[model samples]
Target: MTCSPPAAPGPPEPPEDAAVTTETVTEPVSTPRERRGWYFYDWAASAYNTTVTTVFLGPYLTSIAEKAAGCAEEGQTCADLHPLGIPVAPGSFFAYALSLSVFAQVLVLPIVGAYADRSWHKKRLLAWLTAFGAGTTLAMLFVTGDRYLLGGALLVVSNILFGAAETVYYSYLPQISDPDERDAVSSRGWAIGYLGGGLLLLFNVIAVLAGDSLGWSTAEIARWSIVSAGAWWAVFAVYAIRPLRDRPPVETSRSRSVFYAFNQLGRTLRELGSLRLTLFFLIAYLVYNDGIQTVITLSATYATEELKLEQTALVPTILMIQFLAFGGALLLGAVARRIGAWKAVLASLVLWAVVLVAAYFVPARAPLQFVALGAAIGLVLGGSQALSRSLFSQLIPAGKEAEYYGIYQISDRGTSWLGPLLFGLAYQLTDSYRISIVSLIVFFVVGFFLLLAVPMRRAILAAGNEPPRLL
Candidate 1:
């Protein structure tokens, strides 16, 4: 995700020499070839999400950190490793790395959007970021033994690069598709991404299962698995960017200030003050999405600590969600085409509320019930998110899509902490994970009402964007 585009006036045109070196069009035109390319980028990027972040990195990094702390096993309790004279727990290494990466994204992504919006070669920028990000992931292959600090640094850098590339990639949606077709396009991208990520993860799972038989150490297998994802990302991205077209910058002037993106980001936030509907939608999205992400981030913990499920069982559940989510994105996209994106998102929120309630009542040590709950989550997960992106695309100013999406990224991609904070507080008070899990209803209920109040067409027009036919 990225920042929302600004509707405020742009700077005057710069000299021809300052112009970006790319073919320019009068306005963005949607084409089937370009759309397919855009979809493949998602497919490429999701490998990082599924393989590195979701499946491999946490345990691998923790194992490295444990080694650094003189522990024999990954999950062993040991003294904190003091890197650069700062104490850090081995178990928390991955979490701390994730936090640091998200912090970097929050600071940099808006500026990335600002520069991207001003450039004619946005696809080129996307390709460069993808390469750099993949390179960082590839470097993970060398993060062996007790190099926990190096592993943590790579994770942070790769994650930031991942977010930056994603921000640029998302900025393409408005330029590549019509307003009404956005739901379908975004949904297809997400579905393809899920498939790609799931396929790689499935392969890795098989590899992990056969590691002992193949006479490979778990560490070696993990290293190869991690690097394979990077290879997959780099290889697939070439095809993704090949067909994407270049669109002319709305504002041709290049800001010379070293603080241009920062300055522009400040201006963008100020501009959002007047775009009430867009702001309202952003607020609603932030609140509810925090809940959705918290559910995703904490689900494994719930299954382990509360349900007492084994790690082996959780792997299959995660795979189930990944594969099913592909269908879910398409399913909700069809619903969006029938009704409207906004309404479809609203309906998904209702379903989210119900899912939380069901989670609260699920029996402890019930694997079948837990599997059923996972299925429910998988069905609603991709649909809600895909529709949210499509719906927000309609609410931002046309020329500033990347910029606004940078702002949007501040809360998107599991960055927001409010929901998790609330969950933690609830658990701390009552020692009941179930109560904490269900407590997220505040976000959904409030978001649903906030969304209800948004006048979609009015917001689109106010943002200087054309309203979708259904909206």
Candidate 2:
């Protein structure tokens, strides 16, 4: 494997007789303040992941959708109904919401990513998307019992903004870290993110418990959680805005606009055949990440529905995983130093496969399953995600980081439905949750083998040689 040279300094200056004046240049170093600002975006955005996506909002929305579908005349009980054109069932509303969110993410993230790259205001674009997501999350507070449509609409909007912000965030990685320090910087960002997200989640958990003691209704607690998520997002985003500098826009033809970004994206897709290893890595990532996302999205639901775990117990368990993931991400960074980032990711995939198999056998034993699964997931989740970000940052060409990362976001969000579809099928077919857990292992195994075949260093070199394109 051949490594590419680090980015060179500016060209030598012309002699005094030179006719044209040269443009002023800035040093390439990423300052500590700027790096901290970048990491704070992760901290700000992760509150949504912890409080809304992973823990509180999903279950609460599902419950509301179900109750709203309940009979009005009976005032006792009613059959479950599915909204969003998904199949009618008690849990199906959440499934529909997840699928819709994933679908929108697949469509919107790449386009926005490409557009952001062509424009000078990447951070400004990110701020807008963040605010959109935060506002939508706060809007969820108004959804009461039987307000399934309202809740679903809010989720769709929030999730779309969330996914778009992520594309912007990942694209910024290359700008913020020198080639030599990429992995270390990326790892530190993930570590800080986990710590921030976990700490906030701990506070939310306490708030929920305290609300119960204070005789707050379920709706009141849910509303408080939703409002707090938005506040958290807005507060932390201030740091990101203060220190990060935006790259100046590259000059283009008069025809270029947001729509033209898609044309550039088309060119990038056409050229993908020249970057064989990157293409392969994308395929592999799509498969395995599907499983990873499914696990994260569905774990709470599985615990509540299958294991009969209470919301109170499940929330704390999820919080524990968040804290544990901080250590896990740091350890994996060390592992990456010992081995390569690619190999460390492979090891994590292998661990995931093993953990999924274990999940199959231990579903009935709630306590042991909770502890075991949480630890196993915590061990691999941060490492796999953070390292993948660093590795991909290396592969993108020097000037087109945002454009390529947009394509990367497509892969991240596009095939997200497969795992959930499979899980739903397994549950429907066998009426058994165990089979659903077992089915995800295939994604990890297949992705691992595919990853083994890709040559990372070669891909980086090829990407370096390519002309910058928005996609």
Candidate 3:
């Protein structure tokens, strides 16, 4: 999702010998069309976030691995398989695959962000990754019975691109919204995403629920769902690629060499101490966002393995989360206007802690309880995430929004790998998803106190922006 505005026509530059010069000028306010176009990518990208990442792919891929490993039926005990000489419970395959994808992102995305900030073609870069990722997602239709490796490989590549593109997408936030308007704009994008994700998920849920009567196997239905998400992502992405303006490189001369980009990055790293308050906030966000993301990525898997919910119940339960998340994001944005975005975020984090504790005790046989848990989670999911990005924007230096956002994106998507990896390891050791989930509470607890301690006014002033108006 490219949030930066397109280059509008400017008055022609004066000839070198002309006595007068014209300065390139930009509109002070974003037009409605530009705002809508900015929101489109979030709307489009959410399909994959919901259908492939959050709901279907992990559980479905695990089933494929289980079948390949000769496991049959629910309640049958399957021996741990070591496909690559490493012990792996059948349930852990998809989670581990997710962790692997995050690991790749942690290594690649920083450089990608640095380069994207220096490239004149942010729109093209965003489009290339979107198409590449979406194509890989569509290829999941071919990952049948014993093709777990193909599924895993495709997921790794697509998910990495997803994170990489997001680095560019998120950096555009400050470019579009004024400080006072950012929370609302970011929340709107998130809410729109949930709406789009929910619509596609609604279709997938129906397909899964009706598969038996239609003479299609459950696996067949899931593969189709994955492909649909890709189609949704590709089709909606065009709105962003075509309408939103492309930004010139943040620093034109910096774009001249690959080494120059990293050289600048090295200088930024050396200056981290000057931005220590923002550093504190980043750490706090890193921990808590990890918990939030871990729950999101693995919720369906947890419900399937621990709650024993059927696909019919599980998929619809996820659909419920999607709708609720849309409302929740918008609600928090409104509430943040009254209570301050920082306090609103703190409130959401507390609710997250409540959700984790409540999830641990939800009885496996009670389908209604699982549905309720999904609702509670949806309420805080988008609120916390949307606000976090906006709040971080306030702390970044002017003219270096994209450069600093590279580090912020590192916290956003780069940190995603650690949570899944830790979650996977916990499951590998305990074979209890309940225990693994509850362990994530430590991150939330730590992040809360750290956030409470950050000097907001100081951070804003340090970044050379006025302190945000809480009301």
Best by TM-score: 3
What is the alpha-carbon lDDT for the whole of candidate 3? 0.80
User: In what order do the candidates fall by TM-score, top score first?
Assistant: 3, 2, 1
Candidate 2: which stretches are off by over 4 Å? 1-28, 71-86, 250-256, 411-415, 465-471
Candidate closer to the true structure by TM-score (higher is better), 2 or 3: 3
- Candidate 1 Cα outliers beyond 4 Å, as residue runs: 1-28, 63-91, 217-220, 256-258, 301-311, 357-366, 414-442
Model 1 lDDT, residue 12, Cα = 48
> How well does model 1 score by local distance difference test?
0.80
List where candidate 3 sits over 4 angstroms from the true fold: 1-28, 254-259, 411-415
Clashing pairs in 3: 5-245, 6-245, 6-246
Error of 3 at 329 (Å): 0.6
- Number of clashing residue pairs, candidate 3: 3
Rank order by lDDT, top first?
3, 1, 2
Q: List the residue pairs that clash in candidate 2.
A: 68-146
Each prediction's total of clashing residue pairs, residues at least 3 apart in sequence or on different chains, is 12, 1, 3
